[model samples]
Target: MERDLSRQELTAETLVLWEKTRMSLRNCIKRVMRSHGVEDHKVWGTVHAYAFEIVKLLGTIDALIDHVTKGSSTREMHPWVRNPLRVATYEMKWRDLKPAIATSEAVRIISERVGDGPARFANAVLYDVEEVTLEEVLEKAEDEIERLSIEYSHPTWYVKHLLDLLGRDELIELMKANNEEPVRYLRVNAHLKDPDAVILALEREGVVVEEDPHVPLILRVVEWNVPPVRTEPYRRGWVTYQDKASAAAAYALAPEPGERVLDACSAPGNKAAYVYAYTCGEVELTCVDINPRRIEEMKRNFKRWGVEAEVVRADAARLKGVLNGGFDAALVDPPCSSSGSYNRTPEAKWTVKWRHVRRYAEGQLRILRGVADLKPGRMVYSTCSVTVPENEDVVHRFLSHEDTYSTRKPDVPVGSPGFDRWMDRRYRHHRHMIRLWPHRHMTEGFCVTLLEGG
Candidate 1:
């Protein structure tokens, strides 16, 4: 095993890995720390906070780097140089670290990883960045879109999209919420443990939680001295961390005892597990996804939550001959740009593009069609995306093509109605869809729609 590295070095390494692989911050941190043989939760928490915040403010930090480098963008720099400078700049600007201390640490890491020349170059950039304020960078933006883009650390296109969807005031509020620490929720695994006992155990373990009024099984985490995963309740599988909006989807689907259900594109299987627990493991479930790694993860999660299902590794969009259809109900939670989850996974704000949204919309329609072909009585189409194309537009297109299927209002009562109009068209059934906003709902940006047909 490799020797353990300091938190700063670990954060730099994790940032570089995230940039190179475009993996989520959590996965990158786990890989980096595991490689270094480090298992300290305190150190992991420090590295996670630093790395996530740095990535969350990447657009601003990169702009500062460009300003200091006299127009040479961070894209031109080596990962070792770029990521370390990001860490250093984030510390100096956001964390209020002294420039000298942040620069010294960054340069030391760069020197050890690369060489003295690049380290000296990084040192020069940090020295220049210290004098440049974020306001100066924002003032340089040519227009409002670019200004908001840099200020909120979001892509230019995304800023424009949100501005159009939400007016100026609401957009700013959503952007601010996206930058804050994501809210955490724990769902009591009622099948495996008593809900009252689980809540008592969590409180005993110092995890403060309050029950969600709309959804009884869901608990909003108020505060915690220990990480939820480290708590004995979580260890005993009495509670699982899930977003409130996500838990709402399983309830929206509302699979009953002995109903045949399909979880299309399910991976890491939170929804499926919730369904199992909701029905007390009496539902006949089949979960499908194309990724092998996620399939393995879903299996492990099922084992932990005591969920049983027919797990298949296959493309959900092309599930015709691989498995039998005729599911009584299905949850078609397709892969999406994850726009709604930017608050929890800030890296997505930088990586997701407009074209990717269109692509996801296409794939989402295909999965819905494939699952519809299975002749389920009802299906819940959901995504952790607030984008219209992936939510309403896909549903509209699917309903248009598959005349047998029609939208119904989901039983979920907490979220707002979906957008009825997109571009030049009007979706008649959009009123039946549900949308959760981070700013308004205190949940991940999510969309859920129930359809009954065939």
Candidate 2:
């Protein structure tokens, strides 16, 4: 009983931190665990699962709380009271925990942490939440967008945005896919180990995987008795986890051996490492990123994969005097709204807004213009986003200003063409851009466009 109470308290505290800091949920969990000196993997796993599940359904959960409280918003409540109530409501509704037990645990935690008044309030809220069903709250939605948002736990604005782009049936499919468990893929490091040998090693460790059809050396994880990271093959760096669509971006770049390749806005450099592995360490790689911590992480990753590259710490948007112009190929993978990655990073669904998407498109255009000045023979701009503004519009805006470069159809075979509608007229080279959908591709939504210098 005490163990269960501790878990609830820990999860509530983690949620409070996430709300306060607005950092990634995983990072917030790490901070809470470290502060409590909690190192048990079992506890970590339990807390992680609970926190992520609650956060993934935040919109729905908050709506339920608001409905029960009768016009009171969860945002107005104290974190101590609010988060504990959220944790309890999730347990009751989603985890199928006995309402009495879930409410009792939440009230106990709130009473111990805040005081009796808040605890009493939380108990009343949970009691009310217990009587209501999610379907009841969803039925109150004023429109289809709001209903879909509540049902799938996405922001209402984002649902409407997707509906505008994909229409009704496709938008619902995407929302359903976003709420499901994300698929994991492994890319065998063919530079260090033979693909067959890596597969044999993974199977020996009780990991079931199958080859991805379109992308060479990529495998879909079927089942695993042991975590892949703890397995021998992963320990030896023979295989690393990467989405098949992400790996496709590197293939689109297709840097040849002995050519100078620039990876802009690249840190935690998975794609750059893939390029090195693709060329068997023969490509001259230079990676640029602004974050020091991610740069260190990328360095560690490079060492593990036997990859060699020059790391530069600077903004990709303003690279003059920091880098030279001569390069055979370059990859411009700037950060964006990350809408396509909501399944894996559900926190982003709440954090990113339409305004942020417009800002991202602006920033993406700047990075493209900056990188284009360097005159790489070929460049691929990619983002883990499904929005038109960040993909096709950014490319269109860049090409409008920069006449020296032209769009080329990405060599990769998978994914659909970019949307052609721009201001009621067709974008000139919309077919040159490729979009991978989570519903269709079983991968994170991604957009890739290839550009060539004359």
Candidate 3:
């Protein structure tokens, strides 16, 4: 029999993996672009995941770069500026950690690889890092980008974009909110128990929790790491890991028990599972994705939740052969550039060149148009992207071309309205859409648009 690793052992391994993954992520982006003929979604997406986990441990990569370039130990600095030590300094200075402890961990973790002299240099320079007021830092920075980046602990492009969209004061609050550890939110499986009861159950288990006004069954974890999905209640198909905003997308669809629903692009099937949970297994759900591996994940999630859904590995755009106006509703959560997810997936900021956003928007429109023709009744179109081009623009273009389709606002309780006309005139009716932002909603930026048609 294999021995189960203890928590301390797991944590130690996770830390080491985190450091190595960070290095790989930074290197992979450049290497893939240079050696491989392709630099597409899959490569960038995997890199983004690695980058996200790295930032969660060590904070922003930008700050690490700045420190390496300016630190006193220039001779000892890693030539690439994407080393574990640089990330270590950012964590010590910006993230909540004593400088000595963070730097010591960095040295311990990277000493052999970085060499004795470089390790010593890293330790020395990190000790010099001191906490300063945002005001003090901003006062010292002459450039607006540098000032905002340091003050908010985000990339310059991200800060500039936020400033343009939300203005300076709001950007500060947004950035501050993003830098903090993200809260884990859950969608209670109402099939097993009511949300209120679930909250009580969690509290009884010594979990500190809070309910947000914006979403139903969305519980924010103040403390505790009890894997709810692994618990008996969850095994009995009672709870699932779902964001407040994501729950809203399924809720907006309001899939009634016994309704036939199609979940297009349902890879890793959280939303499809939520639909089953929400309706308590009464709905006949068909979940489809292009990747067979993702179809397998959907099956695993379904098995975990004790829910049944027809999982298909097929292109959502080419679903014409499967059913002919046979579904009551459908969910189209298409692939996107994920700009609004920068706070949670910081690696995306690095991979996202200016052209990527436009390209994603164009692809999103194509998918929306393809799916609009197949909606038997009302369908919900969604993405994890908060950008106007991908969210509202695609919806707008779909609506313009298919005049038979009209916007149907999901009756979600809370979320800021979509961007203003000044930002994007095409999304005028986007107020009905839900825009979840890390700065505002404390979740990844997600937009869901409800469409009504044949």
TM-score of each: 0.97, 0.97, 0.78
Model 1: CA > 4 A from native: 1-4
What are the per-residue Cα lDDT tens digits for candidate 2 across 205-289?
A: 8999999888777899999989899998898888999998889998898778999999998888889888988887899999999
lDDT for each of the candidates?
0.88, 0.89, 0.66
Off by over 4 Å in 3: 1-82, 94-109, 120-142, 193-200, 208-214, 220-230, 342-344, 422-426
Better of 1 and 3 by lDDT: 1
Supply the TM-score for candidate 1. 0.97
lDDT of 3 by residue, 211-264 (tens): 867666667878865555445555665666677767778778988988999888
Tens-digit lDDT track for model 1 on 102-135? 9999999889888999999998999999999889
lDDT of 3: 0.66
Candidate 3 Cα deviation (angstroms), residue 380 = 1.1
After superposition, candidate 2 runs with Cα above 4 Å error: 1-5, 422-425
Error of 3 at 305 (Å): 0.7
